[model samples]
Target: ALYYDNGTFFTKDLPKFQPYEQQANFEYEERFKRTEGKAPSGSARKCHFCLHRLNAGMLPACVTTCPCGAMYFGDKNNPKGLAMQLLAFNRGIRLKVSQGTEPRVYYLTSEVGTADNLKACLACHGA
Candidate 1:
């Protein structure tokens, strides 16, 4: 059913944002230049869902590096697809629903106590 549903056009620049903090982000840029001997492209860059990486038959950076197995990806049609099953089971919700931009990315609702490594710091601190 989902496979037959036509999806919107996907592109690298659909989502855009202004440059973030100079100190925080620029630190990464500086490190990249020091380690890799090349300057980063610009002051800021947005996530493109790792289009080039996907094209190269590799997983996205976030999904690959996410700790605690939080990220999921794969073909939705496959019965064994983790991403599809998680979404189909209603454990995940789409972001920016009102914008009509249906993204494949999903944030799982079933997972609990992820913040601060499941520690109730706020509750204990009486905040």
Candidate 2:
């Protein structure tokens, strides 16, 4: 799932990277043996609340990075629900979607917008 980004430059050669994937799997096992029982990815701790999804509210990075007040984040169950409102605004349009193992990140963009360029750029530029 991590290796399958549409915008990643290496997306075209992913099959050729299979051996490295196997090597990573082996390295993980070796690291586990060395550490007894610890995450091979390393020891980084996040806030407890940050670990859980809080509905369609502001995701972590968006909340932190928005310099302007353009981005809004909150629960979707409000009388003015953000998620429902946004979807309703696009009722007739198609929404491209993908299922990840457990996706905690969401991007809101349209085909005609800067988002489209971003996706294409990622595919060829290793974003």
Whole-model Cα lDDT of every candidate shown, in order: 0.53, 0.41
Instruction: Put down candidate 1 lDDT per residue, 1-127, tens digits, no spaces.
Output: 0111232122324463223311222332233221122224443455666776777899878788755455678876796787777777656677898898877667666555557533443444345
Q: Which sections of candidate 2 miss by over 4 Å?
A: 1-61, 68-72, 90-104, 115-126
Q: What lDDT does candidate 1 reach at residue 86?
A: 70
Reference-based lDDT, residue 74, model 1: 83
User: Judged by TM-score, which candidate is best?
Assistant: 1
- Index of the highest-lDDT prediction: 1
For model 2, the local distance difference test gives 0.41
Give the alpha carbon lDDT tens digit for every residue of 37-116 in model 2. Answer: 33334444233233223333437454555454334454546647775565445432323434433432234455455565
Candidate 1 colliding pairs, count: 0
How does each model score on TM-score? Answer: 0.49, 0.29
Evaluated at residue 58, the lDDT of candidate 1 is 93
